[model samples]
Target: MQPSHPGMTPYPGQPFYGWYPPGGYGLDPSDALVTPPGAGLGGWFARCVGAARRGWRPLLPILVLTQALPAAVLSVLVLAVDPSARWDAQLASDSAALPANFWSDLATLLVVVLGGSLLLGVVQAVGWAAGTWVIARQAVGESAGLGAALRYGARRALGLWGWTLLITLIVTFGFCLCFLPGVYAAFALALAGPVYLFERHDPLSRSHRMLRDRLGLLLGRVALVGAAVIGFSLAASVLESLAILPFGTTPLDSPGTAVGAVLTIAVVAVLTLPAYLAQLVGLVVTYAEQRAHEGPVNAAQLAAELG
Candidate 1:
């Protein structure tokens, strides 16, 4: 027999991961988002694939606008303001001294990269929130539209962006200290976005709690997601780098070069869409599973909470 109460966790090792329904897997067979802790990797995978299939209509446009386009603009900006031309000059001059404007160029490069990161963070905030809304809706077989999802994103973007910036700072500080610490910080804070959206308070601490409670499982799931997204990103970067080699250090010098640069970036930007989809679906669904491990929840409850 199951625990007398749905919330009771009999095993000390299991913590908040209580009993599922009689089906021996999830809370309900009819729902994709209710996969409890005992449902295993298969359950989580099914839910992720289901969320993607159900939510793609809204997800595609949301990702393209917030994720892809901003990325394209940032790429263009970085290439346009590249400081590498000075390096070429320095090499050609065969001088032991640095370029006269080397420091200035380096400053400009840092500004563009940092500034572009901040702007891209804004769009990514919107995309993450909107994508969550769609995933929650479609997980329960309910319709989620692009307009409504985007509107919801607009409402939550500021708060999410703020949290993201804080996480970024923490990660940066950890990196300053050491590489391992930075990676640990990233894994720990990975769930903050979904936690903020679904619970709205102390997301950083709560996400850390989830990671602490189920370290191995959460690490495996999150690492898999990271691998997929990072792999796709590396591939895109390589393609974009190769595509721009013909244009030289300063691609914006001529109209033809500028057009080639933009087009190559545009292609690479489109290629980023899969990374976006995998990231959104994988993390959100994984977060749901973490919630299931914590306490009683279902697709309907999550959908209601998302609002």
Candidate 2:
């Protein structure tokens, strides 16, 4: 049985509405009189699963392209410039005075690669913010066009980009200030996105707020999703490892070894699609929970759109 509304007149056989967070708080966790945290968690998990099922296909290609292009281009440039062991070996043998031109060219190439990577990082951070905003709009039931969503996100891109750079610097400085705390600080800062996404709060402020909130629930959901990701990643690693097992004595030290490597990569790419989808699902669910429990966001739109 379902209740028509919260705490008004109960439907026949319907439980009371005390299970919900409160009046004006979003969705009810369940029909129970006293809903436990586990019930809230379960609802969130289900919401994540449902949202992922709907949005994955439309969103994934964009996500991949956004992340991949700059990374691939930057990596290629880096590899092109970086001196390989073979080159170093050849140079070592011919230590009969290397040409000044070689040294200058190598130095120039290294600088170009490094500069390209830095530039790519700035651009990619913007792209990631845009991607997240697209996911956010979809969660909110806006029939937002990718172009429009990206444009909206672009308005905040500099803020997102600057925040990321600032965090990177903080993590680096923290590491220098104290190696152990720095490592912990890096992981602790991961909650900044949920803050930005759910509370519409700034990343730095979210970090502090989440610290106060004990991050247990958020991290719990993230861990569940991360487990799924790791499982897929491990499967891929296993396949790659097995490829080596087939040629027991033969070392994977040549172009021939690429046959198995390529196959493994292909399989991994195909399978990891679901894991990536799950990540988006987890992200949306986190936001949905906020909309439900916190009255700031219009949960009515989510129920209609995501329903």
Best by TM-score: 1
Candidate 1 on 1-307: residue-level lDDT in tens? Answer: 2332232332222122233556333355445776666668898889888888888888999999999999899888887778788687886787787877888888998999998999889889999999999998887668888998999998999899999999999999999999999999999999999999987888899889889999999998899899999999999989999999999888888999999989999989999899999999998988888876665566777777777
lDDT of each residue in 14-117, candidate 2, tens digit only: 33333343343323444111122345676666666555554565456555544444554554355344455445566777868564457776886778776786
Q: Which regions of candidate 2 are displaced past 4 Å?
A: 1-40, 91-113, 175-180, 197-201, 225-280, 287-307
How many clashes would you count in candidate 2?
1
Best-fitting candidate, scored by lDDT: 1
Candidate 2 local distance difference test against the native: 0.52
Estimated TM-score for each candidate? 0.89, 0.63
lDDT of each: 0.84, 0.52
Residue 82 deviation, candidate 2, in Å? 2.0
lDDT score of residue 218 within candidate 1? 92
